[model samples]
Target: MVKDECKTLLDALNKVSACYRHLVICVGGTSDSQNLREELKKTRQKAQVLASANKNKLTTILKDKTISKDDRAEFERLWVLFSTCMEILEIDMRRALDLGQEFPLNVPTKHLIQTGMIGRTSAVAARAISVQNMKYEEGNDIDTIDLNELEQDISEVGEMIFEMEMKVNVLQWTVEAKQEPGTELKSTVSAGASSLGMISVHGDGNKKLCDTNKVFAGAMFSAVLIFAIVLAVCIVKFA
Candidate 1:
């Protein structure tokens, strides 16, 4: 029963990963903006459901003393992948929803003037600036953009080419870790071998010292016996 549960979790994770990949491709601009938004919404809902359901399983698997070390490690890895995918998906969703809104068909001359004065930036940044300018022009204080959102827009073009860079970095790191699996384990094994080698060297030195002492003692005993025999012969001759 436990094995089945674990396998089901793995399968679900794989499906989520695939969904993330598909979303990434869609957000790459191959799909129309409307279609992209739809895809993002669908994928986000799927991920949310997966997270809600499996989070407990993830915790349980990690905490269960009965599970093997390998199983726990596998679950831990999947959890990381799941979390990362969810984050990038969220960023994409927010970018699409906020930045993808259609501007008013009629552009105000005052807003255009303000946007023109702003320095060059990414399309998303320019759009955000233009939208803010429009809002300010219309005295729409209630809809004024947040400073942090403006800053994020300036720093990232989440709607276009820049969308994949963060995800790529994340996935690249994960792949590298997987490729070089057990680096710490290798170091630990090396340390254990070195410790055993040191003990073996010390044992050999002690054995050699014991052998040398035994040889010396035997020589001393032989000399004492010979001297005693010679002294007895001399005593008899003198008598």
Candidate 2:
């Protein structure tokens, strides 16, 4: 019985070993993010089921009256390692899940101009108004903000915000007992994360994102004001 139980425990350990190795490869290699994520999830689930089965088998072995103390102790030691491995896999799987949910969408949205943060937001806002004026150069003052690697860093921050949003949603559901899906809920989460992600990127440039936010709002209002003036002129000329 002891020999049989030991074999079962060893088999479960081997499965866990294979899963962890695959996870590492997926994370660092150039594979589809969604596919890799699914694989990791399956691996974690399989490890958990195997771990439970091994635990039950060990319990049976320990229950046998003829089993010696040394053999029972060996089985118990294997169980501890099995339990620990399962726990570690669970933690990693959770991190991946938290990243994928909450419609946070990392909405990194579009490329942002760099001039908005520290020195001026108006210049970039004006240039953006005209497609012909929008230009980028590596060393130019009007260069685009954030490199691909930097974008990845912002994505990591977005994931953190996603986690925060999930906790807040759970708390809100508990308190209000309201899980109704509203159209705006999805947009709100996406916009909030997008705005926050922008702030993070801008902040890295020694500038406050709020400064840019105010400038943007001001630009929109200005455009409206100018359009209103033009409409008034047209009305007066016709009148």
Candidate 3:
């Protein structure tokens, strides 16, 4: 029975190894490799720390007299699995960093900016605005306005900087959107409509101005027409 249990444990370990091998093959040369390597490195570092803290834990478990041989085999198999996973994870981390260095913008930076703690103009501006508003509220005199308020003003200036940054981002998005078929068509149509609207508004304003000028010129035109008519009537009455 002990032999059979050991065989079963070995079989399970073999299956685990096969599954891991397949996963490695399937994940080959993919972005996950770098990520996995980093994760493995971290995991190994953590494992080392844990092992140092509890140096006797493995020996204690192995020395348990009540633990069946099969149970021991199972535990060993699990350890192997853990070790393999950690190694793979480390390899992935290295790969990821290399890829990042080679293709810097392969990963989108927007998410990082959105979630980042510092260096964003929007965030800086917001902080500045808050500080300035606080100082203004605290009754700081004009010449002696609080430093805090000045800091806030600096932060508020970040708003314009942030806006310019956003415009650049939007321009990039627009260019990319134009490359897409449907989006390109939509943008073209929208632009046409906007241009037409602008023209219509300009034309309407010009027409109104032209009409006013014509009204002012109307008296001169009418006087000339009436004079001609009166001269013809006088000639007809005399003849």
Per-candidate TM equals 0.36, 0.36, 0.23
Best by lDDT: 1
C-alpha local distance difference test of each model: 0.49, 0.48, 0.41
In TM-score terms, candidate 3 sits at 0.23
Question: Can you write out model 3's per-residue Cα lDDT over 100-217, one digit (the tens) per residue?
Answer: 3443323454322222222212222222123232212223222222223323433443443343334322222222221356764897899999999999999999999999999979
Q: Provide the lDDT at 54 for model 3.
A: 25
Deviating ranges (above 4 Å) for candidate 3: 1-60, 63-66, 106-239
- Total clashes in model 1, counting residue pairs 3 or more apart in sequence or in different chains: 0
lDDT of 1 by residue, 181-216 (tens): 677699798999999999999999999999999999
For model 3, the local distance difference test gives 0.41
Runs off by more than 4 Å, candidate 2: 17-32, 102-239
lDDT tens digits by residue: candidate 2, 119-142: 322232332133343233323321
- Which wins on TM-score, candidate 2 or candidate 3? 2
Assess candidate 2 and give its TM-score to the true structure: 0.36
Candidate 1 residues lying further than 4 Å off, grouped into runs, are 1-36, 102-239
